[model samples]
Target: MHFCELGDPGELSPSQILIRTEFSGITNGTERHAMLGEFNWNHFPGRHGYQHVGIIEATGNEVEGFNTGERVFYGAYVGHRAWHIVDTENGPPLLITLPDGMDHPYCALFGVAGVGLRCVRRVRVRPAQKVWVVGQGLIGGFAAQAARAYGAHVTVTDIDENRLSLARSCGTHRVLDACDERVFEQLKEGGPYNIVIDGSGYKDLFFDIQEHALLARRGVIGALAVRGETTFDWSMLHQRELSVEVSCHFAVEDLTILRHFVREHIIHIKPVVSHRVSIDEAPDIYTILRDRPAELLGVIF
Candidate 1:
């Protein structure tokens, strides 16, 4: 990847805003996919990043509800730079204004948190339902918290012991290491889960859940991961009439609901930001995430 200087943004349109980056978030999963040529637009020297929080440097004459110097968070297809010219009319307003005392680093989690929230909502989890989130990365972690916040009995699983420990401390009902030989037995002790969310982005883990995990009759299995080709257990699903859904991305409405949750303190995001680094260290950060995932989590740039 290479960086080149660009001309200064000038002559904003009637409904445009110029933003100066304050803090940006690196989406480890998707960004990694971009870097490794797995993403659809995997061309080299490409821009990659979605989560960002910045101060408004200037606004066009037609801009409303936003003023210069105000802080806001945005999700753009490419937003790893120091400045951006955002047009309001060309797209729906996905920009969210930040409260005065909000933490900038936490704002970076908005995109992933919104995705998690959507996954939890898609399954229509009810209070007292057993919910299992099979991963503790940013998306899985947030999904688990959302389930618990909505009054479900939430369990979290991860192959990494540290991540599982962190999830337990962060208020998950139970935490399990998926690699344990007795993981299925442990899960059975609490009875079958009503909703099983796969956020590990590992296709093999999803198949394992289909083969080993128990689901109540007509129970839903949510796939919150980037999917790949895999062999599924047809007989088991047909016998149970189970519902399998794949949840990805987010809608504008999801962000609105997440903003309310943030305002009410229903989902505290401070703990999810496990690392912070400058944007200039992008290369080194990518290396760390690729080689040693356990050493990092949410990284704010």
Candidate 2:
């Protein structure tokens, strides 16, 4: 934390974009995972950094679809304040032209929502298929809702009863306490599940259930939780024919579809939001995210 009376606008070159940030949303999963000293982006494309809506102060020589004073979205995990300069490489795969009816906060949730969309898309959910979502913070909540949009009968599981309440309100069939004794009984009778999405940031379930895992036939697992260390038994997934995947950030092409969804209101990604703050307040807010994370889906500034 440095004390400064003022700061300078950042700099960038071609295929680059410079934005005066108006607002950004905190990705609780990734941000919290990063804070726990358990972050693991070691060999991947690294992390999402951060993305939010801002005014275009400058555009790189090679950039297009953006102009001075234009509002657009871009991401960088560490983030930039006052003014941020990012090469088009860091910008959205494509620029977003905010419609007149939308709010910047809703725009900020786009990146996160895109990931959820991708997860649901991959599920290829069959109409009336039973789906289980294992968390409901931001990612899990979005996944649960998206599954519903895909016409699946969805259920959400979370340790927090309050978050469970939100999931129920968000259209889940039922909430399960994975930490309780009654959890197994709640498993739909006659079978385990056609699909199971694990948004929890832990691998303990995989380890513990490997013994009696035959319960879920043709099961699938999605690890969207942003925790540090998670374990999996590859052979189990192979034996059970469970399709396992991880949900990441949105791809460049997905923006148009998401924009359309947001525009048409066919999908709802707004409920997870629980806080709003400013850039100057981000550092302190980061601590609040680490110590007490529950129902606090987004921190916008």
The predictions' CA RMSDs to the true structure, in order, are 1.9, 3.9
Residues 101-219, candidate 1: write the lDDT tens digits: 66666888788888898999998988999998988988898899889888999988899887787798778999988889998888878658899888887766646666665787888
lDDT of 2 at 194: 72
Put down candidate 2 lDDT per residue, 1-301, tens digits, no spaces: 2323336754566778777778777777766665565654433322334667878888877887778788876654544355566666654554576766766676777777777767776766677887777777777877787787778888777888878887877767777776787676665442366777767765576764465452276677766666555667788777777777776766666666677777766566566677776667866776677776764676677
Give the TM-score (vs. native) of candidate 1: 0.92
Output the worst ten-in-a-row residue range by lDDT, candidate 2.
40-49
Clashing pairs in 2: 15-88, 16-87, 16-88, 49-76, 49-77, 50-75, 50-76, 50-77
* Residue pairs that clash (backbone atoms under 3 angstroms), model 1: none
Whole-model lDDT, model 2: 0.68
The whole-model C-alpha lDDT of candidate 1 against the native structure comes to 0.82
Deviation from native of the Cα of residue 236 in model 1, angstroms: 2.7
TM-score of candidate 2 versus the correct structure, residues matched by position:
0.81
TM-score against native, each model: 0.92, 0.81
